[model samples]
Target chain A: MNAALPILALFTLLALALGLYARRGHDMGLEGWAVGGRGFGPILVFLLLAGEIYTTFTFLGASGFSYGSGAPAYYIIAYGALAYVLGYFLLPAVWRVGQANKLVSQPDFFVHQYDSPALGVLVAIVDILALIPYLVLQLTGLGIIVSLASYGAIDKAVAIWIGAVIVTLYIVASGVRGSAWTAVVKDIMILAIVVFLGLYLPYHLYGGIGAMFAKINTAKPGFLVFPASGQSIWWFATTVLLTSLGFFMWPHSLGACFTARSANVFRKNAIALPIYQLILLFVYFVGFAAVLSVPGLKGAATNLALFKIVIAQFPPWFVGLVGAVGILTALVPGSLIAMTAATLTARNLYGLARPDAKDDEIVNVAKAFVPVIMLIAVYFTLSGSSTIVSLLLVGYSFVTQLFPALVASFFPQIGVTKQGAFAGIAAGVLMSAWLTFTGQSVGKLMPFLPQAIKDFNVGIIALALNVIIMVAVSAVTARKALQPARS
Target chain B: MRPVYWIALIPFVGILAGPVLHNHVHPFILGMPFPLGWVSVWLVITAVLMAVLYALDPANAGE
Candidate 1:
């Protein structure tokens, strides 16, 4: 057996135990499985939403950004805090609409709110197209975590298979409640391990946190501060604004909002969630500590900066505990996306298929798709790799297009024409794709455009165009459509 | 549009002004770069503002 085998097995078993524990003595029905009976109060709702937000991206991506890209990493911190402010108003309305309409999944909201099954279908297609790749990304993160944590004792492919199997079974068995219960365990583990490493790694290596950052700032000059040159402040500000708008727009997040017993749960969570930002700061400390010591991490290799730092500084057993957190970060989100995707598949796509399905039938069909979604994600994890596929991980940009439609739903008087919303979404997706795949953000396309526009994230640029098209088209349509009907 | 709604803009503005205010490497505040320190301060402030908003909102008073 490998040196990591014992602790790895122990943590993995603990994960499975927690999954089963959440299901004990509860009657599992469609609503119970899908949104945890729409009865959860503040604490469970908070944990569920937190689990969904802090995925492999938070664990690996933030530290990677700090190590590789310099100061732009602060965007992660800025966006989440801003999002809570927005969600304070946005989610209560979303929850109110969801509760009134009896919406269980993402597409159900659009269908009931707009009274347009076609719009629901379009949103469903866009959402799932965006979501599958996100699921695949988390699976990939799990594979990397397992492979690296075991010191190459476990193969990446095998590790991903094990992760997929566990996540699939647990989600299928326990549903959103499983994900919530597991999150409670995952958050505790994450808090302990991160704070320990954050304080110890810096102080143990350097004299203290202050000394470490001071030395880096002195050596690299602008390294500790935001880049004053090519990575302009406009880029950072727009990126944060874009991410904040798109933050809770994800299908899983919207569905989770429906789980809250009252809008007060969301309101309370918005107040409390920012406290978790302090934990993210601890991870940032670890990332900043890695810079001078673990230098020369090129490209995707940068994601390993924090983990490699932990390995170099800590013992194997403690490293094993961190590895467990890595797997939890990946698996918790993987299970979430899988469950949400399955919810969409049964609730949305199954409607397109049968046209006459029953509620129980839809629920059963969704439960069945749990394994299929996991299989598809795992297949992409082990076998799929292409530029287009990787670009799909930029789901936030595309999904930000949904903001106009959603805001319209929250207030009926907003008056966005369905055709306009459709056109806007189509335009946003295409613009985002063209800008991203063409490397426009890197100064490859549209040379005549200003550097500032080019420097802004493609998502924000696409969102601007989406809003313009939506508003202009709606104004023209509403003037013509409203006059004849008002009489 | 209650006055409470404007409170949300405090964190939003503080972060958007990141490029303008405290855009420097020197003089770390609590062991962080000025921009980062600026962000960290506003993050906590955002929550406090949210708490105050919660208190002021007529919706919560009914409970």
Candidate 2:
């Protein structure tokens, strides 16, 4: 391995140590640690949200997808902007309820609003299940960074395991405060690296953005066009919508939302997040530039497109910097995911399972679960059964199942009973699984559904079906509840 | 007036309208490609929509 181990070791140690140090105040209790005492201001919220947005996927997978497919990869950039646009209106309502009730998890909101523990547990199980693939995506990204940075000196499996262990340790030590403080540093590094490389690479190779796109357009017109052949209109539309809705449904995002000091913090974060997305637009273009500059790079390892370009094209020190940035990308989200998962397990599962558990004990359990979940993610990363996109799809579909119960919980007059909600969720899960396994896109299965409905990406189709079943069952069971008679 | 409620719909409208307009008229921005055109226009529309939403409702402003 010709890589510089000293630089790599130094940066990793800095991030880990800083993250650990940040946890001191948070370690006081579960609430303090897990949700940052529900006191995050706009800056912390901004970092947390940005950290969630730029995963290893942005660093590696976005470019790979752009290289392999075309134009469709821009959806990553597009959907994020759209998510914030949608959230501007939606989030304040959610924040209001969260403040009113002191809701910890998304499931907590559902349970309190709808008066249903069964529904909460169902949401919790779905969240945990969905998070597995999502966490694995981060772990896989971390593994790729390690493997590439070490230049085959370290086994990918070992690198993933080591990275996961480090993330789990810090998250367990500091909780949400650890995530918030680290997120601030992480976002700065990400923005700096992405902006620096984004401008430098295109200028070095293609002369400018227009020329880059022109070169790509001449070679692969598909890269410039939408709904590229083999990528259906339905798939395009639904994938965007499903991802937009699912963005907020992510447990870590909910955790961040809960941390906001006030509704205005969330509002400011919502408005400002798109500005971050605007910065990421450069990152997306980096993927397109990779296609133009480095064509016909062959193998089953298309995921290495951006990394290969960096290592093969850039100087070694710059490569190390990008590697460190990628590593930070993985670390920030990995810590948040493990922390969020641990929180869910501690608050929803362990607390519910044993109602009298002390806050400290629950916090301890959360800390313990972080390592266990990270290890599970590491195992999957090493196993490498699926590509990054496939893993993300699985996670997206699964978390989408939470939408109906959560949305209905806030509305109250949705008249969805707990039993009905459970049934809906179950039906949604089964249908989504069948669609996913059968190799049918969710858009194709429900043609009559609206663009928003038909384009149900991931498990959102199942969620829609779940909602339908829930409302239908509730109506059948209690006419008065559904109708609310004449005044 | 729930400014956010309406602000949120701007992107939805742009998303719906972007493809529809692109398919028919082939929109362009400062002579760049229309797909890029569509995104830029949609982004502006979404932003304006959000600003309008904030102005209209301003629910959390006092809080």
The top-ranked prediction according to TM-score is 1
How closely does chain A match the true chain A in each prediction, as TM-score? 0.94, 0.92
* Interface DockQ of candidate 2: 0.38
The parts of candidate 2 lying over 4 Å away from their true place are A1-3, A227-229, A297-300, A442-460, A479-487, B1-4, B23-33
Weakest ten-residue segment in model 1 chain A by summed lDDT? A478-487
How do the residues A1-487 of candidate 1 rate in per-residue lDDT, one tens digit apiece?
6567678878887887788678787767778888888889888889878875567877777787788777888888888888888999989888877787788887787776666667678888778877888888787777777888888888889988999888888888888888998888888888898888789878987888888888888778777766654566767888888888988988998889999998888888888887787678778888888998888887777778878898888777777788899899888878888888898888888867888987778878988999888888787767864322233337887678888877876554677766666777778878877876676663445567777665666567788888898778878776554221100
Please compute and give the TM-score of the first chain of candidate 2 against the native first chain: 0.92
Q: Give the docking tier of candidate 2.
A: acceptable
Q: What's the CA error at residue A455 for candidate 1, in Å?
A: 2.0
**lDDT tens per residue, model 2, A1-487:** 4554556666788778888898664435876787788887788888888786788878877777877776566567667777887566566677777777777777776677656676678788888888888889988887788778767666778778778877877787787777677777777888898887777777788887666666777776545666522353445656777788778888888778888877777666666666567666567667766786667754436677787777777776667777787888888888888888888888888889998998889888888888888878777777775667777877777777766766665555666666676787778877877877888753576566565444435455576788889888777765543332111
Q: Count the backbone clashes (under 3 Å) in each candidate.
A: 0, 3
| TM-scores for every candidate against the unseen true structure | 0.95, 0.91
